[model samples]
Target: MNTLLFCIQNETDAMTALVEVLGQEQTALTQAPSLPLMEEINAVMQRKNQLIASISQLGHTRKNELTRLGFKHPETSMPEWLQDQAQVECWAKLMKLTRKAKELNRVNGLLITKHLIRNQSTLQVLYQNHGSTSTPSLYGANGQSNTQRSTVRGFIAI
Candidate 1:
């Protein structure tokens, strides 16, 4: 029981760290790119990886504890085994943190996709302006072919 408590507390702490890193990642993705911000993002990524590893270890420990307590499928549900109020509360907190982390991660993924599309558009414009045949070929949105050629002959600098 003590081991279970320790694992729960460690998992909760790791989840908290992951949430902080994910929040920082979102901020970095939304804002303009900068040296310092990029540095911070890299640092956050490393921290996030470490926290994830710790969480996984704690989860394994938790599974073992549950199994030792005669749970046939420890991974299925820990709440059913938990009788202590404090342990149940800790489980609730861990679940909430997990949900928050998932939400933030999803948002960050969308932000990254938006940034990629924006950068690709910018590159396409720049390539067209340069009037170079060596410019990257792009596939049509209809997904038919990449052979579609642009008809615009004049370059307009913005």
Candidate 2:
């Protein structure tokens, strides 16, 4: 019981950390896109991944402890098994944190998708302009003869 509570607390802590990282991700995603901001977001994502893994491991440990406590199917039976007030409160807090983290993650994912769509639209426009012979080439020297003109059409299929 004590071990299970400890595992729950650890998982809760990890989830809390993950929520904070997700908040950072949300902030980064909402800001103007830049190389440095992208790097920071990447770092935050890595930390978030680590926290998720840690939480998963702690959850497994909590399940094992529950099994040792004689709950056959701990996943479904945990609610019924948590009779003590402290354990119940801790489990409730953990669940609340989990939901908060999940919501933050969902919002961040939407923001990323929004950014991706915007980037893809920009790329499509650039591709169209690059392929059009009528549009003046943005690349190449103004006066010098160039053997090959770099084209973005090849790079972006869409």
Candidate 3:
């Protein structure tokens, strides 16, 4: 019982740390790219990895405890092993925190994707000639056709 409580606390702390780090990462992603910010991103990434590993370890500990307490197939879930209201509350809180962390991570991923696409577009514009005959086209989010070149208003003489 005590072990389960401790595991829950550890998992929650790791999850909270993950949420905070991901928020910091999102901020860093939006800021102007700099050496110090890059270093901070790297550091935050390392911290995120450590927190994930710690949470995983805590999960394993809880599973072991549940299994020892005669809960069948503890790997499946924790509800089967929840013996009291306190355990139920702990499990609920853990689930909530994990959900929040996942959402933040997803938002951060989108931000990174936007940055990557912007950089790629900038490089393409820099390396390619603007007056080139070939025009690249893609669809926008609204399903509208988007061309790299501007449309000519008047017909040109042959």
Candidate 4:
């Protein structure tokens, strides 16, 4: 609870810092050719796609800004440290478009993974439970011996 409160306070303080960073980054992008900008955008996008794909392959829909940008999630549960979110805000200062780029690689990665899963019937096979069954023992559930008492091998008409 304290951590959550801290995050809220920190965000309020950082909001102005974020806006200033964006302003500076936009100025830089305006003066620069798009090739490098394009590349950065592409990188962020790739990471986004990768993060999504990773989660999807895990059969889940969880992603953090850090994960989208190739950073690992710090925990196994909800509200995972908010590291990715912070990372995105940081990168946001560098490029508004990079923020968008983070979503691209993720898209590409997922598309590729989806195709592979489809072609191999992997979706059907992924959830398939396959294994050899053990032969049933000649004993009852209560540990009583199951005697092979046979009256006749053939059925008699009553």
Candidate 5:
């Protein structure tokens, strides 16, 4: 029981850290994309991954402890096995933290999706303009007009 409580508390702490990192990710996603911001987001993601792994390990340890204590199905029997008030409270706190982390992660995923959509839209527009006859051809690496070697013209010939 003592070990279970300790494991639960550790899981909760890791979840708290995860939520914090997710918040940072959310903030970074909301900002305009830049080289430095992208670097920061990458760092936040790395930390988030580490926290998630720690939380998963702690959860497994807690479940194993419950099994050792004679709970047939640790997940469903955890509440019942938590006879002590402190144990119950710790479990509840861990549950609450888990919920928070999940919500933050969901929101972060949505933000990332939004960014991808925006980027795709921009790329589509660029492609359309590049293929348009009225649009001027861009200069090639050798400082010559790319009109003669246009991909749209080459595709049409093929």
Candidate 6:
């Protein structure tokens, strides 16, 4: 009983705090974006924080309600802010960026193949001049003895 009361108090306090913060954020978002873009950036950050807090509080409340007589992980429904198209678009863009990076990496591997083919004759001549008998048949920049290369891996990749 005592623990329940404590949790109730905490839950009420957190709900009130989140509501206040969200109200302030809504007001701020409604106001004009400040000059220089930095202010808008900061406001966006603040709003994000507020949204997180609100979602956390709502989750906690829902969890408390559904919790067994003891332990709780706390369940939560979706937050209102997430219903916005901009939020969905942001998530989509992040996913797209990951895909683009993968495509770029694939292209880099193909370019490395081309580079190995183009440099094979020169590498063979250099190996002969140095009297090194072991110059592995190079294919796709991979069989080359990387011991002579720098400690960095894929150093040229952005």
How far residue 77's Cα lies from its native spot in candidate 1, in Å, is 3.6
Q: How close is candidate 1 to the true structure, as a TM-score?
A: 0.78
Which lDDT tens digits does candidate 5 get at residues 1-158? 37877888888888888888999999999999999999999999999989988888888998898899899999898868788888888888888888888898899999999999999876565556365656444666888756544344235311
- Candidate 4 per-residue lDDT, tens place, 1-158, comes to 33433433343334434343434344433444467866764564455445445434332222343244454652343344445665445434434443443444345456546555665674334223322144334466888854533222253212
**Residue 1 in model 1: shift from native, Å?**
6.2
Q: What TM-score does each of the candidates earn?
A: 0.78, 0.81, 0.75, 0.21, 0.82, 0.30
Better of 3 and 4 by lDDT: 3
| Clash total of candidate 3 | 0
Give the whole-model CA lDDT for all candidates, comma-separated: 0.83, 0.82, 0.80, 0.43, 0.82, 0.48
Candidate 1 local lDDT, 60-157, one digit each (tens) = 99999888978899988686867889989999999999999999999998998998899888777656644566865354578654554444446433
Superposition error at 32 for model 2 (Å)? 0.5
Best by lDDT: 1
RMSD to true structure for each model, in Å: 7.3, 6.2, 9.5, 21.1, 6.0, 17.2
Task: Give the better candidate number (3 or 6) by lDDT.
Answer: 3
Error of 4 at 137 (Å): 72
Q: Which stretches of candidate 6 lie over 4 Å from their true place?
A: 36-158
Poorest 10 consecutive residues by lDDT, candidate 4: 149-158
> Which tens-of-lDDT digit does each residue in 32-141 have in candidate 6?
54564447546745764665565467446645654654334433322322345654554344345445434544554565466567568656654543334786433337
**Residue 98 lDDT, candidate 3, scale 0-100:** 92
- Model 3 per-residue lDDT at 36: 98
Q: Hey, what RMSD does candidate 1 come out at? A: 7.3
C-alpha positional error of residue 42 in candidate 4 after TM-score superposition, expressed in Å: 5.3
lDDT of 2 by residue, 1-158 (tens): 37777888888888889889999999999999899999999999899889888888888888888888899998987787787899898889899999999899889889989999999878666646445546544455776444444446465322
